[model samples]
Target: MNHNYKGFFSIVLLAWVDADYKFMWIDVGGLGSQSDAQIYNQLELKECLEDGSIGLPPPSPLPNDDQDFPYFLLGDDAFGLRAYLMKPCSGRTLTREELIANYRISRARRVVENAFGILAHRWRVLLSTMQQMPLTVQVIIESCVCLHNFIRIRNPAIQNIQLDNEDGAHNHVPGLWRQDDNLQDVDMPKEGNRDTVAATRQRDYLKYYFNSPVGLVPWHDRMVGV
Candidate 1:
């Protein structure tokens, strides 16, 4: 396997998590040399999402609205945009609506971030170099995920203190996991593929929806400093 951008042999753990920070789907053992976009592009989950074979819910109207919207996954700029997947709008000069949309996506992505954070903080083994063979390391990682999900399901409060919280104004408060250096984020490539037409349209629609009367949250304008 190739060494990652960090110049060390590593494995990429691709995970899809829910709002509660539980893993919905995970693919482990990709060589770390690949960028996140590269690894994700090859995932079966991505294929399923694209082909609409993964049994996702159908498009539905947002609350108090007649306009229907497709269910989509929120990802960072590291991932490609798709009708089923939404990422932050990129660029330094963005509109107020675009900035609010980006802020919303960032807040949602924290579920994934804190999920990995709690996983690494509790299972400290992931934080260090494993001397074991690649196969063994894979099993160790899978086992940790299983146990992590089980604990979350059985006793949801097990890692409450480890999660990120929000203040009365909805400002983010970093979780305890952020204070630790156990798990570092995967390196993103400097460039991404051009957004597909459908993806661009969907993102634009969301930008409009998020700023509209129905989708607007009271704190959104304040959060984005609009």
Candidate 2:
């Protein structure tokens, strides 16, 4: 069970889930030590976009009339920022605007986290580490995810059953940051190297949008301490 990347046995599961908690895609064979950004970059999402298989809406016209609103994947700071993928604003000293943007993005990204939580809660196999070989573990993980989606599809009302109490609280309050025990922080590249000029502009535009009246929630300022 030794992995070439980390010199120990480990397997990474990269997954994409929809709002309904249905798994859209799952990649279970990556090295455990690989970064989220690395795994995400290797996904076929970009290729699909190029082939027009994925049709994303243009950029928000309310925020930037001239810019196309590129639909993006929400990710934590462990992932790199891109025009098609967004990570939270990083820094110890963030402006009020930046804080709001981070909160909103984090809020949106919680669906993925909730999907994982529900999967682990319902499937005890995921609750404990698997001692099987990498390939076996990969199969188990993929099977569980697929089964999870199948169950949800057959019983859509199961989605209403809250598996995690914290999910309820956070869903109601948009800007609260919850610390996940399973996630380990990884240092991202410096801002200068993280994104292209267009990506930065796109993020800035979204930041403004979040702080504006259109995107602003009543408790946003208080939650973000803005």
Candidate 3:
């Protein structure tokens, strides 16, 4: 988050679990413009659920050093790991079964990308407004999320089929939203391609998080809901 560029935006990821599907982890992530600089401005969504910003649990061999606790751990990948950092496997290596389980878990994290797709095409925030002031940008981003979550939850009441395979895999069921052909402009990234390194890294980091032990429940069985 301390990084600087011509303009800056901090990424915020809202991930969850879905128990009924084959892949149960769903990650919904995005960038926060300026309104997110202070803690208060983020209070509404801060309490939304587990944000991975917290430091790791007390280390093994329990050190007396006060600074050992995690702090200032920025980035969306960090936040997404908060939920996966579950019990009993914090410092342990995963078994083969666990590895397969994690591979599936990693697949589920694509929900974040899908969510962004909806936001970009339907909401217009990511498509345009490329020049808003920092604070104003933040406000708009927050507003979109408020509206995003509202629509996401409320849609269930009327019976909808927008999200397919909430079981968490990178899947496309006929009843749900289809992959946008335009997405190919950015997705299906070419390996070793420098032009899209950032996107590639983001995908890798997401994979790394799912494959590692950073959640409270540990990547055990697919829960269908995060």
Candidate 4:
């Protein structure tokens, strides 16, 4: 497993969250040696998605559009681009429309990012290495996730303040988590099969859709500065 700059062993936590910032699924205890893609490929969730047993919503066309698009997860460039997973276009010479689409995807991805932020903020133990057995550390992580979900569901108003908010002008207001030390992000290498022809086509369609009248948000062009 890979160690940190401090030469300490670490584990990667893979999480999937909903729009409400609740953990829908998670995989913990991935050795620091493995890349994000490697750990992701081993997930049963990936198999379920492939076998159509994950109960994902059926593909539907965007508003006022006829081409159907699947509900996909937003990921960063470290992940492989698939029909069920969308990532930003790589390279600097992107078209204006592509940049706008990327911005929209990023905006949506903040929910998942915020989820992790809240997790580390609430359970500060995750901010530091737990010098416990691997099995025990896994239990601690899982227990924190369960408690987070419980608090979020049983009493959402309390967590509302913990999350980032948006102002009337649509600018992001940093959450309480950002005020103090937070979790560190892993710098995973890009996967070998990062893109496929079908995936590229799907992403292209999304780019076009986001630029269309129905998909364009009022602030998108301004945000992208295009």
lDDT of residue 159 for candidate 1? 93
Clashes within 3 Å, all models in order: 0, 3, 26, 3
Clashes of 4: 3
The local distance difference test score of model 3 is: 0.39
| Alpha-carbon lDDT, every model | 0.85, 0.68, 0.39, 0.83
Each prediction's TM-score against the native? 0.94, 0.77, 0.40, 0.91
Supply candidate 1's per-residue lDDT for 3: 86
Ranking by TM-score: 1, 4, 2, 3
Winner on lDDT (2 vs 4): 4
Best by lDDT: 1
Q: What TM-score does model 1 achieve against the real structure?
A: 0.94
Among these predictions, the greatest TM-score belongs to 1
lDDT of 4 by residue, 1-226 (tens): 5473346787778888999999999999988777677888889988997788999999998788887889888888778888888988888799999999898888888898788888888888988878898888989999999999998899888777877887876767987776764455533455655587888999999898899998887777777877
Ranking 1 against 4 by TM-score, winner? 1
lDDT by residue (tens digit), candidate 1, 93-181: 99998999898778888888899899989998888889998889999999999999999999979898989999888888999988885
Give me the runs in candidate 1 sitting further than 4 Å from their true place: 184-191
Model 2, 1-226: lDDT tens digits are: 3353435546667777777778887777876666555666678875775465787776565443454577777766655567877778888999999999998887777787767766766676874658887778888998889888988899856654643333432345321112334322312222222666777888998898888777676677877765
Q: How many Å off is the CA of 115 in candidate 3?
A: 3.1
- Candidate 3 deviant stretches above 4 angstroms: 1-99, 157-160, 166-178, 181-226
